[model samples]
Target: MITDLIAGLFMIAGTFLMFLAGLGLLRMPDLLMRMHATTKAGAMGIGLVMIGVALHFLEAGVTARVLIIVLFVMLTAPVAAHTIGRAGYFVGVPLWEGMLKDELKGRYDAETHTLASPPEHQNKEP
Candidate 1:
């Protein structure tokens, strides 16, 4: 049937995206770049997989569950990435050299981080 064929197509496309994400994760260099790979591929992979799976089932409950999973992935991916990035920065993982400017450099004075922050509203430490 045409519907079955469409569903099969979705599954193939989703599988391909997931595989590409895996490749990005493996090949990307540096934490920031790798993080980019992780976030993009992760979201796309899950989204396509869910879309494929949902269409394959076409059941209300399964569709709802897949939607929920998609929502959860969207909500958590950024938070997790920020946490990991912060940890890497605090632990002193050097950033890639192609980066022309480091916005965080002013806030961090090499050996110690300034709690005062660069924000205009933040009070400077005396």
Candidate 2:
């Protein structure tokens, strides 16, 4: 009984996060923001859902598959998001005007399509 209740809670929470991801995709003003929202929320939602499934099943094979799927998503989602964001930036997609910081400013060489590392003094975080 308790296991079922916990599983139900996990599923509901995961579903809510998934819904928020969709809403963010529609509502975010820029490509990077939208990507950020969807990747973070979607991966987390998948992880939670998988946990619930594993708990509910309590079977070796099913639980193993769930763990693998969750691990894969956790490993890949951030890397994929970063790659997509880099691609978008290189393609000249504009950042939101309200953005506070641009760490990449003046670092990219347009002609060679390369990025130089920040100077020694600028390396310190603000």
Candidate 3:
């Protein structure tokens, strides 16, 4: 059936993303980059896998559970990554040597332990 085909494709795609995420985590040079790999690709991979599960089940209870799992992963992954990265930065975790610009270089006050946006970012209104 069409649903099975779609679900299979999603599962395959999710597996591929997870594989790439693993490779990236191993190959990336810095903590931030590795976190990027794990959070972004891993989250997407898991979300897709959940979507495939939901599609394959096609039951109200199973679909709802899968959807909730996906939503929680999607919501938390980025925030978790950001929080970890910020903590690492605040603690002076060295960035990769190849890194060009540090946008947060002067944006943070070490003594105050507070972060402020860049001038441009501050001026912009949401």
Report the C-alpha lDDT of model 2 over 14-126, residue by residue, as the tens digit.
99999999999999988899999999899999999998998899899999999999999999999999999998998899999998998888889889999999898877878
Q: List the candidate 2 regions with Cα displacement exceeding 4 Å.
A: 124-126
Cα TM-score per model: 0.80, 0.93, 0.86
Looking at candidate 3, what is the lDDT of residue 38? Answer: 93
What lDDT score goes with residue 100 in model 3? 95
User: Candidate 3 on 1-126: residue-level lDDT in tens?
Assistant: 999999999999999999999999999999899999999899999989989998998999999999899999999999999999989999999999999988899889999998886788667899
Question: Candidate 2: how many backbone clashes?
Answer: 0
Residues 34-66 of candidate 1 have per-residue lDDT tens digits of: 777778777777877787788878899999999
Whole-model lDDT, model 2: 0.92
- RMSD for each of the candidates: 4.6, 1.6, 2.9
Candidate order, lDDT descending: 3, 2, 1
Lowest summed lDDT across 10 adjacent residues in model 1 is found at 108-117
Which one is best on TM-score?
2
Ranking by TM-score: 2, 3, 1
Q: Which ten residues in a row have the lowest lDDT in candidate 2?
A: 117-126
Candidate 2 lDDT score at position 15: 92
